[model samples]
Target chain A: MRKLKAVKITQAIVELVKRANFSLRKDVLFALRKAYGFEKNRRAKTILKAILDNAAYAQKENLAICQDTGMPVVFVQLGQDLKISGNLKAAINSGIESGYKKYSLRNSICKDPLLRGKSGFSPCIIHMDIVSGNKITLTLLPKGFGCENKSQLKMFKPTSSLEEIKSFIIDAVKSAGADACPPYVIGVGIGGSADYASLLAKKALLKKIKLQRGLSPKGTVPGLERELLFEINNLNIGPLGLGGRATALAVNIQTYPTHIAGLPVAVNISCHALRSAEIVL
Target chain B: MKRIYTPLDLNKIKSLKAGQEVFLSGTIYTARDQAHKRLVQAIKSRQTLPFELRDAVIYYCGPTQTPQGKVIGSCGPTTSSRMDAFSGFILAQGLRGMIGKGSRGLGVKEAIKKYKGIYFITYAGCGALLSKYVKSVKKVAYGDLGPEAILKLEVENFPLIVAIDVNGGSVYG
Candidate 1:
């Protein structure tokens, strides 16, 4: 078994958080630039241009891309053959705290859901998976609340048709409207149970925002993603919802098998500033 | 495009129309969820406010921590709809304008029309770029709220689009 020190995990997380906050992912940037080219409305075009300029400025200055540094969510793919020397969870939390403090990122996590106390950095949300590998992979997604608040999930009956599912997804974006900030990158999760579907939807957001992508390896419908993307952009919500052709930059779908009684679908919307970073150790 | 300054009055606000791009300068106060709640409570209890409300513009923002040697950190507009619940009362207290992103609730639209106030929106999720306009910042109230604290910011040529105007005209439609 390969041994790794806990402090090493802490150090990696610190750098990952900074990278995620300070820069826009290249894939996302490409989508934004493409949308800017396609947008015809003068206001929409201007908004897209400003968005591009903002991303560039944030990266150059080593600053937080947006004021809401977001709730730090860490995805850990732990290798079956690797062993850790110290408290792994503690190490991760301490790293998050140190990263936020060191770089002046906002402390957005509240201690309690109901009481709503002061914000702090420790105890970030973590999802762990044991995989067949010798190296650990850590992916960080700093989810801002504006778009996160608009996430929707529905348990459709087994008999529901594809059209119904498509409408549901489109309606989710329609209801989100201008409130969550557009042009949005949509992530859809289908077939899992309710909570699992929500997780899958969020995971779908981590997929690269490519112009051309293949069918999901997990058996999700192939043409549905493309159809949904076309229909959503037609909503005229546009960038900043001022109306234009570039309402949605991309629509990514992920699927898993489910029981015969139901089909659960969840939609996760990300604003233009979708920030994430990953590291392997 | 038009140029406007803060401490805006009813006449200046009424002259503006929705969808007009404006470059705003001068002072504005920053307040978000908690600060709005506290301000409402202070008003209800008949206590003195941290800043004057007459002809004032309230920006719905919560800025990041100021970096060393900088006037402020990434200070951007947050969702304006989240503050809709408190806006009617706040507007009645002589508030002249609001700056944030997204569309307002129906009540807020009605309030803006009734009170002859203007609602301007800056680029959403563009905090780092927006911070360049802020020439100076200082904590005005609720210091314990950390980022949520009310702040007084002096800005120069801040870019804004009039999302809603005093005549109930809205760019959202």
Candidate 2:
């Protein structure tokens, strides 16, 4: 078994928090630029330009990309063969707290949901998977609530048609409109139970936004993502819902096996500033 | 782009139309979810507000902590829709204008039309870029709320696009 110190994990998480907040991912940037080129409306084009410029400025100045540094969500792929010497959860939380303090990042986590009080930095949400390798991989996604609040979950009957599912996805983006910010990245999770479906939807956002020109895998409905993308853009929500062709930068779907009785679907939308960073140790 | 200043003139605001880009200068107050609640409470209770309400432009924002040698941190507009429930009351208090991103509710639109108020939208999620416009910031009230505290900001050439006009016309349409 490979031995790793818990403090080292803490150190890595601190760095990850800073990187995720300050830098917009390159693939997302590429998608935005591509959308900008394809956009015809003058207002939409200008909004896209401002978004791109903001990303650049954030990276150069080492500033949080948005005032909403967002809720810290850490995804850990822990190696089954690795042995840890210190408390894992504490290390991660302390790392986040220290990083936010040191970098002057916004403390967005409330102590309680309903009885909300002063916000502090700590107790980051973590999802872990024990994998085969000896190295641990940590990915941090600071999800902004503007977009997160617009997330949707529907338990469709197993007999539902493909068009019905597609409509639900499209309507999710349409209803989100300009409130969640636009040119969103739509992530769809098409299976599993209720909570798991939502988790899958959020996890799907970690995937890179790339331009692909073909069908999805064999079992799933082919061209579902492409068709949904087309329908969503046609809604004309545009960059900031002002008007244009690039309402969604991409639509990513992840599927899982489930019981025969039901079909669960979840949609997680990310604003133009979709930010995440990952590190392996 | 049209240039406007704080303590906005009603005539100037009336002349503006939805979707018209403008550069705003002068003083504004930053207030988000909690601060708005407190302001509305103060109005109902007949208590004095931290700043005068007449002709003031309130920005829907909760800025990040100020870094060393910086007037403000990443300061950007938040979603306007969240404040819709309190807007009619706030507008009724002789407020002139608001700066935020996204659309407003129908009641808020009706209030804007009735009260002759203006709604402006800056770049959404462009906090770093938007902070460049802020010349200075001072915490005026609600120190306990941290980022949700009310802040007085002096801004220069703050870029904005009129989203809702005094006529109830909306760029969102």
Candidate 3:
């Protein structure tokens, strides 16, 4: 068994949170650049240019990309053979407390659903997966509520057609309008249970944009990813929903085997400022 | 591009059309979900507002804490739809304009038309760039709300697009 100190995990979490909030992943930047080059509408081009410029300034100034600085979503890949010396949950929480303070990131977590109170970060969301390895991997995704509030989940009959799934995603995106901050990076999960499907869609969000921007998958739904991307952009929602081309940067999908009688699909949308970071220790 | 100043009068707002880009300068107040709710409640109780609402423009934003030596931190527009329920009441209080991004619900559009108000959309998620336009910021009320606290901001050459015009033209169309 490989022994890892809990403080090492805590330090890595702090760095990951700081880096994720301050700079966007390279895959997201590449997709935005590609969209900027191909966009034909004047207004869309202007919006895209400003977004890219903001990203540049945020990096140079060591500032956050946006003010939301959403709740930190940390994913931990713990090795089965690893032995942790300290309280893992406490270590993670301490990292969030210090990281939020040190970086001046907004603490958006509220104590209650309806009642508003004094501001502080409470209950940072963390997901853990046990994998076979000697190394521990941690990823931080600062998910803003604007796009998160717009996500949807629906359970369909097992006999449902692929076209039905496509339309469902389109409908969700259409209803989202500009509230989700298009052009979005759409994440879709298919064939799992309702909860599993939703979680799968969010996990799909961690996929590199390089794999989703224009690439399509084969088998049960051949080229469906590319097809959905084309149709959604054609909706003319555009950047900031001011109407133009380039409404979505990419569409990524993850699938799982479902029960014999049901098909569950989930759609999770992400804004252009796709912020995430990862580290291995 | 049109240049407009804050404390905007109805006539100045009426001259605007949807889909036109504009640079707004001068003073505007910032408020988001919690503050808006409080404002409406105060109005219902006939309590005096924190600031005079007549001809004032409110920007819906909750900025991050300012680091040392910076004028302000990253500040950008939040989604407009969440505040839709209170917009009519706020407009009735003599607000001439609002700054936010995304589609406004029908009620908000109706309030804009009935009161001859305008809506503006800054580049969403471009907080770093937007912060450069803000000359200064001061807390006006609701200090307990942290980022949601109401703030008075002085700005120059702040860029925005007219998403909804006083005459009811909508960019969503």
Candidate 4:
């Protein structure tokens, strides 16, 4: 029997939540820089420059990059062999509460979808999975509502081909317009049930734009993400959709073997302020 | 591109156009979905608001709490469309400028044209960076909405993009 290793995910969770609210990830900054380099529209390029500069200033100042720090969301893939030293729920909640309170991060959560505390960062949503491994991997995401409001998922006919999936993602981004904030990361979950697929799609948001190039499995941009990038950017929404290139920095696709006759696809939209952090314990 | 802090009185607001950047100095009010609803209700009943709306600019913001000795935390613009329903009503009460991100639906566009009001948008999610421009905070209202409540803010050299102009020029272009 592979005995469990006593690991505490709380400390890491606390850091992850606060740090995520504090600033954006390094790879996210790199993606923004790259977009700034390649942006075509003169106005869009200028806008991208200011945004890139702001990201750096936000970090050095130890301030949140965006005002809406977003709600605390986590996806935990616990290794079966990993054991908990402390109370997991307390650890998670404490970390989140402290992060928001200490950092002065906005608490955008509410008990009722329509009403909640003035603290923008109330109510947290967490999902856990026990995978086959010795080390636990926890991905924390502080998802902003601007993009969350634009996310969509639906079940398509099993006969839908790759072209159909690509079209759906393009249309989704186009429809969202400038609301979700352009130069975003588009995560598409395909091949899961309607419900499971939405969660899976969000899980895929963990993949940063620069990191998508060399994923462990097959490596390099897959058929899905490559087409998604070309198609969505072609919409000419550009940075902030002010009419120039650099609409989406990247599109990431995650799939699972699903039952026959059911093809579900969900698109999780992430704004340019991709404020998220993670920890491994 | 221009960053300056000046009083947001009627004369200053009257000369401003839509899509023109103005770094508001002096005291400006903040409100969003909840407060807008209340403001509209008060107007409907011929009741005065907590503050006057004539020639005033109401930022559609719900800011985070400030740490000790600070005026505010990361504060940024929100989806302006959500507050569109109350804009026309508020504009009628002499409201001049509304600031938020994202495109306003047709209703808001028409309202802006009719009322000679302009819409401005600051950089979204750059709340922390933007807060530095805030010189001081006078008061907070509707605390129940958390970040969504109202703030009486005084900013210096704040940056924003003129999203919509008094002449009907829109930033959505």
lDDT comparison, 1 vs 4, better candidate? 1
Model 2 score (lDDT): 0.90
Per-residue lDDT over A130-195 for candidate 1, one digit per residue giving the tens place of the 0 to 100 score:
998789999999998999999999999999988899999999999889888799999999987999
Candidate 2 lDDT tens digits, B2-110: 8999889698778999989999999999999989999999999999999999999999999988888777889888888999999999999999999998889999999
Taking all chains together, each candidate's TM-score versus the true structure is: 0.98, 0.98, 0.97, 0.91
Give per-residue CA lDDT, model 1, range B1-173, as digits (tens): 68888789876767788989889899999999999999999999999999999999999999888888778888889999999999999999999889998989999999998998889999988999999999999899998888898999999999999999999999986
Model 1 segments more than 4 A misplaced: A213-220
- Each model's DockQ score: 0.83, 0.83, 0.85, 0.66
Which sections of candidate 2 miss by over 4 Å? A214-222
CAPRI band for model 1: high
lDDT of each: 0.90, 0.90, 0.88, 0.76
Instruction: Write model 2 residue lDDT over A106-222, tens digit each, in one string.
Output: 877889989778988868999989999799999999998899989999999999988899989988998899888899999899889999899989998998876866666633533
Instruction: Rank the models by TM-score, top first.
Output: 2, 1, 3, 4
Model 1 TM-score (B-chain only): 0.98
Q: Residue by residue across B46-158, what tens digits does model 4's lDDT show?
A: 88677778777888887777866666777788888889888888877788878788888777788877888778887776777778878777665566676677788887767
RMSD of each: 1.7, 1.3, 1.5, 3.1
Task: Let me know the DockQ for model 2.
Answer: 0.83
Candidate with top DockQ is 3
